[model samples]
Target: MHDRFARSEWFRNDRFGLFMHWGAYAVPARGEWVRSYEHIGTDDYQQYVDAFRPDSFDADAWADAAARAGMKYAVLTAKHHDGFCLFDSELTDYSTMHNGFGVDVVAEFLRAFRARGIRVGLYYSLVDWHHPDFPVAGDPYHPDRDKPTAEGIDGHEPDFDRYLDYLHGQVRELCTNYGDLDLLWFDFSYGDLKGEAWRATELVRMVRELQPNVLIDNRLEGSGGEKGSIITAHPSEYAGDFASPEQVIPVRGLADETGEPIPWEACITLNNHWGYHAFDHDWKPAKLVVRTLVECVSKGGNLLLNVGPDARGRFPEKAVEILREVGDWLADNGESVYGAGAAELPKPEWGRYTERDGTIYAHVLEERVGPVALDEIDQESIASVRLVRDGAALGMAKAWMAEGNPGLALVPIGPDEAFSYPLPDPVDTVLAITRRSAPEG
Candidate 1:
């Protein structure tokens, strides 16, 4: 029997999640984007390992904050390109618990998140730099020195087979220790090598066998059938549990070919930097975060906003503050986001739409010089329009329908002289347009 992830209640209902990328690497405060970009030597990179002492590392606090921010699940880096494990794994001595911070991070997070009634997802990177057996490291596409090089593999002092054994052992420990996980978010694939493919498939199978409810990502499969071949190639066209749209948040109110708008989550960072950077103090404003969430939800996608805790294992004050602000916004109008589908816009460009039940939440992001034009929305579906900020009726029942189409007469309601906060809210206020029926001509 095929285990369909898209149909899973845990995934569809949870349209907002959190992604934590804290590790020994964050100690340097450079950025996690360095593993591939920076031409730093192994000795220098390893220095961060020694300095990775997270005195304030509190997994419960992180999980609690995530739950407060309306997040349903959290994905943490179990193992990154540096081959560092966040848990107590016998596979490698370069784990968080053994390295310096003697704490089982993954286990701690899992327990705390589960306690808060939130699902936990593990982010495991297939590209291991410490492993002598891991191939395709020196390739132009992937230039991480931590990844195994061809020459290093051939003249390896430590046995390659032994490394693979250790890797599998750690995987076993993670699955076995975590009771039951919601997702295994795998990153990077070593082409179609027999060994790599075999290990990936075996891992998926093993995880599922242990926890039948566990979900897997697209990285489990290679281009064509090789060792790692459980999922289909070209995941966007094919099927999967959730569409992991990285970095770039789509223009508002767009969808994939599946017609279901493709169950997606935009994994973005607080700053432009994914990891903590000393020089990068340009933290995104709380308003921008709210806008990002609103935009993602409007497109029927989840927002997995990322945060890189410092070496002390605590989120930056700026990040925390913004998250709290986002939480406050969600507390009031989350109905427009959670479990909502991409709503149909009247003109398809004036604004974006997100729907739940019979309500259509319109997000007007663009500033219009004249009156907001639209090709008359299906008024039969609309019940009433109200501002989400203060629940004020828009009084657009008759005005909603124009000559040719239903155009919006945006009378700025705030106390501003020019335009009242552009549709009357301090920040970006969602218009909760309640509808009576589904959209139809």
Candidate 2:
């Protein structure tokens, strides 16, 4: 049997990526779901589209920021739920080509990120409120679902099959027009709009044919909250390649019925909102971002962090600063993150444990009073212990404090087996533990 997660090899290794949510919604300076949240009519929302002019947009700058943030991949919102196309879609006149500064945003993004060796992906929202054939009244997330006629949409009999054709056609355009995509992130499936309601199987088949190696998220069969059959013994045809958990990380990561690890990623925003909100100053600190990334890596999952660019196509200054700080930290301790997964040992009391190639990375998030106990690790198996940031050798000894527990293996943080209060790297002081090789037969 083919490995269901074979295509996710790169994704697993990457472990960190950038997710950009930019479109006409950026013009409003509100979140991406502003229309649905505030019940804004199509006519009122069209004004932002008319005013959308990202003249200061520089794709290279965006790519540079991601690279500096140590992100190995990126995904841009080609067509968000608002149905505004960032790419040059021949099928639609309501795109950047017709509305915004006439630049093919998706194409530029792909080129810039690809140039920087960042694997590029596009986020296509399955829910398009602008499309006439798409159901409005009685639909779950539509702005005018309660009163379709009230939202500047002329009341008419909607043909969902026609909408599916358009959706499929646009997906095809994305697959064909883009040279080689590494991922295709679908927005969602909620209420009764999931599975065949969007002709998901057919759409997935077409995508697979066009981009065989592209990693697809589970949204085709599930949403952010629902993981779908991807975590089951037998997944559906449209089960997708990876579980996409949004906003929150999985408590224990994801696994199949057989206990095999399932490929998963946590899509988290740098701030509270996905789209650029001028007043949303609630940005996550660089320390939290770094620790969050380490947590994801330790759980055998990737972290696709988001940055919502403002209307002028510039990433918020604070976002850039935070990313730079994260990059600075990654520079010294990237070995503990990239290609690292959950260690065979249990979670350490100090922090988490990630392993790669028999080397255990003890991410010391807290400072312990005595020699940090390397629980569940045998003293004979330990070859060497060193700090990941500076490669300073840390002494391993059975400190007198742990005399009561002779079986415990401890690594002292200070001279004479004394424990230090403040760790060298306060955010995450990673200790690299190399396991001794087995005797030759």
Candidate 3:
């Protein structure tokens, strides 16, 4: 473990990451919540464990796919809420080492991804349904919630404190046994169990000691607990490096209590589910995927696009195809996105803006009326404008002047003039505008 670890420049500059949701749940070809949604008890759920043999699971292939898609980092589920461990943990018998796989998936993930120069993160669910010490009957997402299993029927009592010790021990193993990890993403916290209830302070201290730069997420809180505002140094009793907003991107990037900006990442699925769902063919198109990445960067946030590997431990063909197309788009227009953040200007009606060093990438996602209106910027300040992909300098002029308007780029409304300045295709085609050196006040 590298004690000098912390969220470094790599995370902030990369702006995009890959999230993988895999476990025994993928064996069912259902979503990650297969057990809880179906209310299947431990005995019935063990069928997946018995059948779990991912002969086609190639960590290198997975890493290559991520690198192709221009993902700089990736996070894999080391253990899900179902409590199946992908790693060979000495403390747990129910791990990939003993389960049918008989392989350390986490080790493979680290070795393969690192080979491609991609940083790795591990996702560990705090709520373990399989652990006997975990309150199976009381926890809402537990498979045996409100129902008695063999242990409950035999008059066994659940000791949550013991579970905490096990959880902390497993975390220690993750931090120590493996090499430096970029992130230790905890799944969630909810209800009264939020925050300090998990003895997060002690756990965080231990993690920092093990790997000083390991970035922890907000979910260390109990189920349904708050992931607090990133504006504050310590959102709760525990301090984390960033905010994790799942499913939906924030309307605007988060701001702290005092109105300072907060670093955040939007974790979204490529389709309807996070884990393999055989019938979840309702996938998002590559166009939308690329735009979403640009959108996150535009809002001063990161996008963690997810991929749910199938039962054979390979990405579905559809997902692979989508990623390939996205890779192509990124290859051409990556300059506008990588290392860029919110331009701090008003949201453009046409699309969005991402700022980096001395340039602004104007992403046109929608068709806005007439010449591009750079809402608040002065027309005189733009030194040059070039189509991001084609590399052609576009001519500009002060087309209209209004009460509060300094000026907007002028373009002819006629058909023939359209040929002079053509729009970039693929929806999120970006225009790289170089700002002139600002005049001294």
Candidate 4:
């Protein structure tokens, strides 16, 4: 049941998924953390709720864009730290249904993604800024945390256990209503709010009962600072199914104390903001996006790349275009990226390498003006080598025994002069190396 037990093979094989950060905060177009960042009191923030109108939301387009980008699964922010539920929650009045959207957005997300044969996941936040029973006292993430609840215009005495009922009730609704969920990505638990505070054991048990096969994340470790580690407190019972790293990829594939690699996913954003912001234009290009995906595979991890749809519930055109280009790259070079894991070989100076079925995929990233060295790759083990970009084979003339190295192979570009390209391909060219023969004894 725990992480040490087993993992879904599909998760290991898929390796790429989409993360959508959308909610009522998107209406502000500031960012997902606008509530805390701006420190606006509850009454002021109600303006967004009153004005929430996303008439242009097209679920099919979102799912199609993700599928086209070679993403096998998607996770949406069913409810963010703001406590705005995108689904129709009967337990609470503060939801998309009350916003007059007259629709259950989560249901829409499920229908579209499921129709395209993509797995579904839901993101729920443990911190609720809008929930009354949830305390604002001493809560760093809360805008009114510093101020006394008695002084706030929209303030009330908070009860800890009452909030738990609401939290558990909402979670049960998500698990029971969603036909089949692949993942439940919880936002996090910070100081003073750890495992027992949320009654995680009972909550997780409920989730398992609802969807036996769905995988859970390790944020339940209650160690908010420990992002890349999913070690459960207990051994036999399952807590979270996987480790989740936010914003950046791990230096090395995340490993346990014993150096055994732990299953993890790098949840990164396409731009500076996770939610739609009309002003934040620091969008990462498509080339960087594809390269990041390859880097994840090489590091033996998955990439949960993010996209923030505007308040209209539509993905920005730039994000769509970037994902389309990434899809094109995956269409051609997926053999080197999908279903691949960390290679036994060390990282080449030129680029990274990923392995699949004993075959090596050398991702040539930089321009090799002279020669590329395969440091420890024995030449005899190479059955054949060809460029994935254009199935052109490379022979012994191109690769041969290195002069000084014992078992290395040097891929020479020219006899006396180096061959250069006017411009390197925007995307990395993968060199697929197949086994020629068994390694010599």
Which candidate number maximizes lDDT? Answer: 2
lDDT of 2 by residue, 1-441 (tens): 139888899999999999999999988888999999988768789999988888889999999999999999999999999898999888899899998478999999999999999999999999998888888777767888777383325776678898899999999999999899999999789888999988988999999999999999999887887989998887999999899999998888888888889889999999999999999999999999999998888888999999999999999999999999999999999999998888877887789999987899999989888678888887778889999888999878754556777656788877867645578788898899998999999
Model 2: residues >4 Å from true position, as ranges?
Answer: 148-152, 399-401
lDDT value, residue 77 of candidate 1: 93
Q: Write the per-residue lDDT of candidate 4 for residues 1-441, one digit (tens) a residue.
A: 234536566787889999999988888899999989988777888889777779898899999999999999999999998888899998987888887877789999999999999999999998888888887766777877666553322656788799899999999999998788998988688787877778888888999999888888878654333743354343324347677878777888776666666677888889998988989888899889888888888988899999999988889989999999999988888888778999988888888899999889988778776556665687766678776766777654333335566556655433432454421354787878887756579
Best by TM-score: 2
Provide the lowest-lDDT 10-residue window in model 2. 148-157
RMSD of 4: 2.6
lDDT of 2 at 224: 85
For 268-330, candidate 3 gives per-residue lDDT tens digits of: 999999999999999999999898888888887889999999888999999999999999888
lDDT of each: 0.67, 0.89, 0.80, 0.81
For candidate 1, what is the TM-score? 0.82
Q: Which stretches of candidate 1 lie over 4 Å from their true place?
A: 1-3, 33-36, 40-44, 141-150, 153-164, 190-198, 222-240, 251-261, 346-350, 366-375, 397-422, 437-441
Model 1 poorest 10 in a row by lDDT? 222-231
What is the alpha-carbon lDDT of model 3 when measured against the actual structure? 0.80
Residue 353 shift from truth in candidate 1, angstroms = 0.6
Once fitted onto the true fold, the runs of candidate 4 whose alpha carbons sit more than 4 angstroms away are 1-5, 150-155, 222-229, 232-238, 398-401, 412-424, 437-441
Between prediction 2 and prediction 4, the one with superior TM-score is 2
Full candidate order by TM-score, most accurate first: 2, 4, 3, 1
RMSD vs true structure, all candidates: 4.8, 1.5, 3.3, 2.6
